[model samples]
Target chain A: MWGGGADMADPALRPIQRDWLSKTLAGLVLGAILALACSGLFARLNTAMPLGVRGQLAMWMVPPVWLGVLGGVYFFSSGVRAWLWLGAASAFVTGVFYLL
Target chain B: MRSEFVRIYKAVHTWTGIVAGMALFIAFYAGALTVFKEPLAAWASPPVAGRMVPLADTPKLIAGVLAADPATARDFTIHMGDAEHVPGRMGWQVRDTDADDHDESSVRHYVGTLDATGQARIEASHPSQLASFIDVLHRVVGLPVDSDPNRWVMGLVAALYALALISGVVVLLPSLVKDFFALRLGKNLKRMWLDAHNVVGIVSLPFHLVMALTAVVFAYHDGIYIVQDKFVHDGKWGTAFQRQQPAAAAPGRDPASMLPPLELIARAQAFAPGFEPTALQYQQVTGPRAVVRVWGKDAAAVSPRARGGFAALDPYTGKVINSDFLPGRQSTPNLFVSSFFALHMAAFGGTAVQWMYFLLGLAGAWLFYSGNLLWVESRRRKRPRDGGEVPAQRRDVRLMAAATVGVCLGCVCGISLTIVGAKWAYALVGDANAWLLPVYYTTFFGCIVWAFLQGAAKAAVHLLWLAVMAALAIPLTSGLAAVAPGLNMWVNTSLSSLGVDITACVGAAALGWMARATARRVRQGGADSVWSEGPQPCLQGGVPGVGVQAK
Candidate 1:
C-alpha cells in the first residue's frame, strides 16, 4: 500500500526514500534554533538597553525575521528547497545573534 | 489531504481579507498617528514659559489642597508634564460627593514654578481642549457619544481584522517564498497590487497581527468578562473581574499625625530600587491611617503600561505596605502586552521606530487602497452604463471605492484640519476642545461626502493636493502666529510646536507625491476602464460594448 501510494505522492518527496529525511529533519531543527536565538536576543536587549532603544530594536527585529522567513518560503523553487533555505538562513541568523 | 487543507485555508484567507481589509486600513492609519499623541497635544497648546515645577513642591501643594477639601483628598490623580511633549503644569481632578449626592468633578491646572525657597508653586492655566479632542478621535474614531452602536461596530471590525490577518497567513503559506523579496513595480495592475499587498503584509505581519489582536482585546475586554462569567468562572464573571481589581485599603482609626513628605518618598524609593517615582498620592490626608501611593517608572520598561512599578507607603511611619512587581504567572503576558503597546505607540524606540511604523502604516494603508482598486478594476468592464440593472458585485465595488477613498484620505485631511482648528480655537474661543473635536468629525464626514460625489480619481487627486498644501503651510502659519523671532527659537522653546511643524512638512511631502500620481492618472484618461476588457474612455458610461446587462 505504501509503495502504491508513493507513486501518487509529490515528486519532490521521492528522494526521501534515503538521505532526504535527514535533511528535512535538520531543516526543522534549524528553524527552531533560529527562533529561539532571535527570541533570546530580544530578551537580552529588553533587559540591557534603555526602554526606548529596546523598543526600536524590537521593531526592527520583528519585521526582518518574519519577512525573511515568509519570503524565503514563498520564493524558493520547491517545498524542499524552501525548507533548506529557511534552515540555512535560520542557522545563519542564530549564529549572528550569538556573536552580537 | 494536505492540498485539501491548503485550498480550504486559501478560501478563508481571501474571504477574510475581502471582508475586513477596509476597516483594518482605517484602524492602522489612525493608530499609527496616535503614537505621538503627547507631541500632538503639545502642538495644539501655544508656547508658554515657566511650566516646570520642582518635584518636592508637588507633595506640599497636594497636601495643602487635600487639607482644605476632605473629599478631594480621598481620590486624587496627579498630572506630570514631560519637558519635550507636555507643558509644565500640574492638573488634578477632585470628586465632590457633596454636590447632587454624586461625584462632581472639577479640573484645575496650576502653573508650575519655583518659589523663593526653591519649592514648586501652583497657578492656573487655560484648560486643554485640543488634547482631549485628539484623545476622543484616537480612542473612538470620531464616533458619536449618543450611539452605543459605534462601539460594537468598532469592536466587530477589530475582530474581523484579526480574522483577516489569520486568513492572510494561511493564504501566504504557499507563495510566501516566491514573493518574499519580490516588489516588482510598474507592471500589470493586478500583479503589482498583489506584490505590494504581499510585501507589506509579510513585512509588517507581526506588527499588524499584534495590533489586530490587541485592538480586539481592548475593544472587547467586556466580552472576556462575559466569557469568564459564563464559562471560566462558572457563572461568576463579576467575581473574576473583581479579583483583578485593586485592593481597597482597610479603614484605620488611629489619630492623625504630621508626617514628613521626604520620609514617605525615601520609603517608596527603597521599596522599588530601580524605578523613579513620578507621583506620590496621600490617601485620606487628615485621617489617622493615610496611604501614600508612589507611582514609579522603570528605566528599562518600553511603555507606560509597563512602567507601573508601584509602592504603597505608610505616610507617618515611613514603612512600605505593598508593592506591585510583574507577577510571575503573568510576567510574560504582561510584558507582551506592554511591548505591543510600546510598538503601537512608537514609544519603545525613539524616532527610528516611529518612522518605520509610520512608513509601514502608510504602505499598509496603500495596500488596502490598492486592494479596493483591484476589486473595482476586476468588475469595471462588466458594469452596466445606467444605474438600473446593476449587478450586486458592481454596486459593491462602487460603494467600496467611495468609502475607501473617502474615509482614508478624509481622515488625513480631517486630522490635519483639526490640529489647525485646535490652535485657532484656543486663540479665539479659549475652549478649543468643544468646537475643535466637532470640526474633526464634520471635516471627515464632509470629505467622505465630497469623495462620494467627486468619484475616486478626482477625489484622490484633489484631496492629496489639498492635504499636502495644508501640511506644508502649517509650520509657516505657526511661526507667523508665534511671538518669537526664529523657527529655531520656537522649536527650542516649545518642542511640541516644533514637532508639529516638522510633522506637517513631512505630511505635505507625502500628499504632494500622491497628488502627482493622481494627476498622471487623470492625464492618462483613466488608464484602464474597469467595465471593458479593453481600454475605454475614463468614466464614460460604464464598460463600453459589454452586452452584459446590469444584474
Candidate 2:
C-alpha cells in the first residue's frame, strides 16, 4: 500500500504500519521498569563507593537507559513480541534487584 | 539498517519533533538568555546607595548585624565584588514556605551594612525578578510558574525530545556521509530548509543530548531521589550526608570571633590556587556544625554547578573541610559527573564558550522552527497544474502553522516586551519585581491571540516586527534614561549591563531581517503553501510536490 512517486520527489521506501499503540505502551511501561531495576542493581553492586556518590550515579543512570529502550522498542517486529520480550527482560532485572 | 527500519524511524522522528518542537523552541531561546543571567539581573536592578563594607570590617559587620537581627544568622552571604545587583556587603533571603520550591519571587531579601557610627544598618531590599522570571520560563518551557506540575511537563517534553534525537539520528544514518556539510541553497526551498535543519541538528548533537538528559534530571530529581532512597538506601539516604554531631550540646559559636573574610579567601585560594572566591556563604555559623562555603569559579576547570563550585571550610579554625565540589580539586569520579552539569550549563571555558553556547542556543531554536516549517511545507496541497481553482490547505496543517508562528514569535515578543517593560514598571509603579509576570503573560497570550485571529502568514510578520520593536526599546529606554535625568529612571553603565543593551541591539537587527524575509516569502513565494498570503494563479519557482526526503 506504499506506492506514490508520481509528483512527490521522495516517498517512504516501505510501509511502517506496525502495531504502534502496543509498541508505545511496552516502551513506556517496560522500559521504565527495566531502567529503575538496573539503577537499583548498580547502586547495590557498588557497595565500595560512598552511598551518596553511588546513589547519585544510580539516579543519573535511569533517564538514559529508559530513553534508550524507548528509542529501540520500535525495531521489534511485532508489538506483542515487543511487549513479551521487554516484559521478560524487565522481570529478570527486577528479580535480581529484589534478591539483592 | 533496512529501509523499513529507516522509514519507521523517520515517522517517529517527525511526530516527536512536531509535538515537542515549539516547547523546545521556547526553552532554547530563553536558555540562551539565561547563559548571561547574571548580567541581565545586573541590568534590571536599580543602583543601591550603600557601599560594600571593607573586608577587614566584615567580622564586626557580621557580628553587629547578627546581634541586631538573629534571623539572618541561620544563613547569609557576604558579597566580595561590587556588582550592580549586590545590595550590600551582607545579605540573606527569607523565603515564603507557601511558594513553590523553585520560585524565587516569593523570597524576601534583606541586606545589612555598618552605618557611619559602626551600628548595623539593615534594610528590606528589593531586587529585580526579571532574570529569575526568564530562568523559570527556560526551566519549565514557558510555564507561568516553576511549580512541580510545570517541571513534570518539562520532563515529559525532555523525554520526547530525547526520543526524537535518537530517531533523527537513525533516519539520517544512510545520508550521514554524503550530507555532512552540504547546504544546497537553490530553487528547492524544501531542500534548503532540510539542509539547514540537518547541519544544526547534527553539529550540535552533543549539546542537545546533554540538555535533554540534564533537563530531565533537573525536573524529576526529587522523584529520582525518592526512588533511590526507597530502593537503594532503604530510607537512610539523609543520614549518610549529615555532618557528625558532637557527643554533648555545645555552646553557640560567636560570629565575631570567626576568621576574617580575607583569611577565608586565602585559605580557599591556598587549597586551590586557581579558584577565585567571590563570596563567602556562612551556614549556621552560630551553631555547632558551623561551616563556610567559599563560592566562585576557576576559569581553567569545569565548575560542578552553574553558580560555581565552593570549598567548604570551618569558619573558626580556617581549615578546609570539603574540596569535593571545588572546581580544580574534584576527584576523578566527581569530575566525570560534574562534566555533564558543566557542559549543560556552560560552566567551563569562560566568555568565549558562553558566546558559542549563545549562538548554538539560537541555532537550536532555529532547528525547531525550521522543523515545523518543513512539516507544513511537506503537507502543502499544491494547485492543479492545469490552472484549476486553488485547493485549501488541510485544517491540521493550517492550524499547525498558526500555532507554530504564534507560540514561537509570541515568545519572542513576550520576552523582549517584558524586558523593556521592566524599566517602565520600575519608574511607574516603584516595584518592577512584582509586575514582571503580569507583563510577560499579557504580551505572550496577546500575541497568541493575534496569531490565531490573523492567519499564520500575516501574524508571523506582525509578531516579527513586534519583536524587533520590543527588542529595540531595551537600549532606547537606557539611552533615554541616560539623557533625561528628569525621568527619574536609572541606567547602569557597567560592562555587563551595557552588554545586555548591545546584545539586544544585535537581536533587534536580526529580527528585523527575518521580518523582511518573511514578508517577502508571504507575498511572492509558493502560492499553494501554508506560508503564502492567499490564492494565486500558479505555483512559484519552487518544485511544488518534492518534499524533504523521508521527512
DockQ of each: 0.03, 0.40
After superposition on all CA atoms, what RMSD does each candidate show versus the true structure? 11.6, 6.4
Model 2: CA > 4 A from native = A1-17, A98-100, B247-249, B535-551
Question: What's the DockQ of model 1?
Answer: 0.03
Please tell me how candidate 1 rates in CAPRI terms.
incorrect
lDDT of 1 by residue, B204-293 (tens): 788776666455455544544443334223453344212232366444433135355555667766655555666565666545456677
TM-score for candidate 2, residues paired by index: 0.93
**Least accurate stretch of 10 residues (summed lDDT) in model 2 chain B?**
B535-544
* Highest DockQ against the true fold, candidate: 2
- In terms of lDDT, the poorest run of 10 residues in model 1 chain B is B530-539
Error of 2 at B494 (Å): 1.3
lDDT of 2 by residue, B36-103 (tens): 99899888988888577887899899999999988787899998898998888999999988898788
Model 1: fnat (fraction of native contacts): 0.00
Compute the interface RMSD for each candidate structure: 12.5, 2.8
